[model samples]
Structure formats: C-alpha cells, structure tokens
Target: MNKSKSLTIINLAEKAKFYTSLCLGTVAFVSVFAFLFLIPFVVDPAITSLMADYDTVPVTCIATNHIYTEGISNCSWSSCKEGCTKEATRCHQIYVNYSKIPFREFKYQSHVSWDVVETRFLINPEGCGYPPSVNCSHFAKQYGYTTAGTPFPCYYSRVYPEMVVARYSWDDTLRHLVLSLAIPNLLFVASVGVLSYWYCPGCGRTCQKYMHHFPAEEDEYEENTYYNSQSFTKIHG
Candidate 1:
C-alpha cells in the first residue's frame, strides 16, 4: 500500500484500540461498583421482599387506655378473637422505662405455628423503663383482656418504670436501597455518559476541531514543498 494509505490504516487501528480500552475500562468500573455497592443495597432488598414470608412486623407499642399500635387494636380484639387467641402462642408485649432504667441488652426470637411465624422481642427489666407520657395502667388493662387465658399479660405489664416498644419498618429498607443503590447507579451512569461523550475519539468537539485543522495545515505544507521542487527542476532544465 502507499505510504499515506498505510499511515491511515495504522491511525485507524490505534483509534480502535483506544476506544476499546475506554469501553473495557467503563465496564470494569461499573462491575466493581455493582459488586461493592449495588448488590447489597439493591439486590438484597428485592430478594428479601420476594423470599421472606412476610414483611417485617413493626415494633408493638402498647399504650394506656387499652390502646395498642402496630399489631392489633383493642376494638378489633373481639372479632378476631380466634386469630388473636391463636396469635397468643407467638405474640406478646413488653414495656420498659428508658428514662429511669438503663437498657442492658435487647434480644428476640421467632415462633412458628403451622405455616405462620411471629417474631417476639424480649425485654430485660434491668434495661427496660417507661416513658413519662405513657399510661402503664391502660396497657395492663388491654393486656389483661387479650391474654385472659394465657400467662402473657403478666409478662407485658412487668416493666420497671413502664415503656412502649416500637419496631423498625420495611420502609427503612426501601429507603436505604434507593439511597445506596438506585441513586448511585443513576448518577454513575449519567456521569460516565457525559464524560465519555466529552472525551470521545472522533466525536469529541476538541478532537474533531484538531483533526480538521491539522490535516489542512499538513496538505498546505506538502503543496508548498511540491511547488518549490518543480521551480528548482525547471530552472535547472
């Protein structure tokens, strides 16, 4: 092949290699990010949502005046008494006074009945206390009615100072997944696109402008040289 043609082929090859390297580098970065950050934050929640039998039950908050929050309320207790009575096997309530008594340790376990499962939190009196605003008597009354036949009410009202129990929600898991995985992934993709376009080989503004101006200057110099050589040959002839 002619010298110019050979040079053009070599340049094309080099540009192809460079572009391929950039593509590979982008893929590597995305892979690493997905493994280190995305999988745990994003994939885990989706899997948990699919595989786990039930969404995590929130912490139960039992209040005074026979008020219960999160699980079952006082009024509905009668109608659902069968399930509620059955639930007694797996469910129970606890109160602690955080202000008066320091929490020493918190623990919990799961109880399964037939195909159903219930998570129960164990509160230690040494670490449990009641918040000032809560009415312990109401919780005691509610507990008394619900576990009329069971030994649960005795455990529910035994708080040192009397405190309410609350559980973390599934919404927290979703929120974390979005913040850690979804948002970061989107930002990374957008940044990579912007950067790739800005520095792309022939498509980049600076590269295109340089390639345009540089070839014209080279051609102009070659033409000038050719004319000078012709003038010298004619003079000699």
Candidate 2:
C-alpha cells in the first residue's frame, strides 16, 4: 500500500510540473517582449517631447563665428570586443551676437550633448541626428552661413534658458513607435507559438502523431499501388 501511494505521489508531482510549464512560458514571453522591446519606445517619446521645449532664436541675430568640431564616438568596450564599430561624431555651433537683447552674446549650439550656459540656444531641443554627424562645412552652406557671420536660427527653451537644440527629432520618435509595435508583436507571437508547442501536451501529441502516421500512410499507399500493378500484370500476361 505504501509503495503504491508513493508511486501515485510521484505521478502527481510529474503532472503538476508539466502543467505549470505553460503558465511559466506565458509569463516569460509576455515579460520579455514588454520589458525589452516595448518600454523603451514609450519612454523615449515622452522624453523627446520634453526636450522639444526649445524654440528658434531670431534669424536677425548675426552669427559672428561658426565652429565645426569632430570627435570619435565609441561603442561600449564589450560591444567593440564583439565586433561593433566606431563612428565619427561631429558638432557645429554658431556664435550668435544679439544686437538688440540683454544678453549681448548667445551660442547657437544645437547638439545632443549637455551645455551649461544660459545664453546657449538650439533650433530644436532634440538636437541633430541620432548621433548628430552633420559635416560643419555642409551645415554652413545649407544654412546660408558659410563662415558664421550670416544669421542662422537656433532654438531656446523659455523655461530652461540654457536648454537649446537645432530641431526636435520626431522622426526618431516615430521610428521607435513603429519598431516597438512591429518587432515586439511579431516576436511575442512567434515565441508564444513555439513555447505552446512544447508546453501544451495535446499540441505535442497531435503533431507527433501526425508525423508518425505520415511515413506509414505513404508506404501503405505505395505498397497498395505496387500490388495492384502486379496483379494486373499477372492477369493480363
């Protein structure tokens, strides 16, 4: 009786463990998709909107000098070790001289990097490219200020006087939104579909049974055709 009871307990435990796998798999797939892919998309746009506080500084203000700078932007050391690349990061800032304002000088430095002066300004708070790599010479020609004496517009935040940028990067926000929706939903579906195949006993059994029957069914059909052909030959011969 005791031996039989122990066997029953073992069988019950195994069934419980197997039944729990589906629940675990559901949670794992949902959490991984939500945290890794979705949250960043939500957080980034909110932050970008806040950075969009800056507005264009008047074009009437003359830019006395335009400075173009270059620097090496590096991936993490681990990323580099894993064969990632380093790209050059370039920044352009124009020194704006306000002829009609309290602040005699203002710097139009529309970059993602942090600058700590009140007179500094940007066109959009989000600044330049994903990494802001616009060539200084190209920027000069495009903005109609080749050497920086010509007036160019940059933006500044009313609330945060020091906060400035060239343009709000709504494109990055849109890209993130699309990727978050597309990639996560696809990944979640695939992950859950694969996990269900293993976690659900009935699904596994159905697939396995079908696979097992396929070869036998094919062979049986072939055999029947061969036997019928042989019989016809015997009769007609």
Please tell me which predicted candidate would have the highest TM-score against the true structure: 2
Global Cα lDDT for candidate 1: 0.42
Q: Taking the tens digit of each residue's C-alpha lDDT, what string does model 2 give over 9-58? A: 99998888667666656766786758564454354543555554433333
Candidate 2 has what TM-score?
0.37
| Total clashes in model 2, counting residue pairs 3 or more apart in sequence or in different chains | 10
Candidate RMSDs in order: 17.3, 16.5
Number of backbone-clashing residue pairs for each candidate, in the order shown? 13, 10
TM-score per candidate, in order? 0.28, 0.37
- The Cα RMSD in angstroms, rounded to one decimal, for candidate 2 relative to the true structure is 16.5
lDDT, candidate 2, at 135: 41
Clashes in predicted model 1: 13
Worst 10 residues of 1 by lDDT: 97-106
Residue 223 of model 2, lDDT score:
100
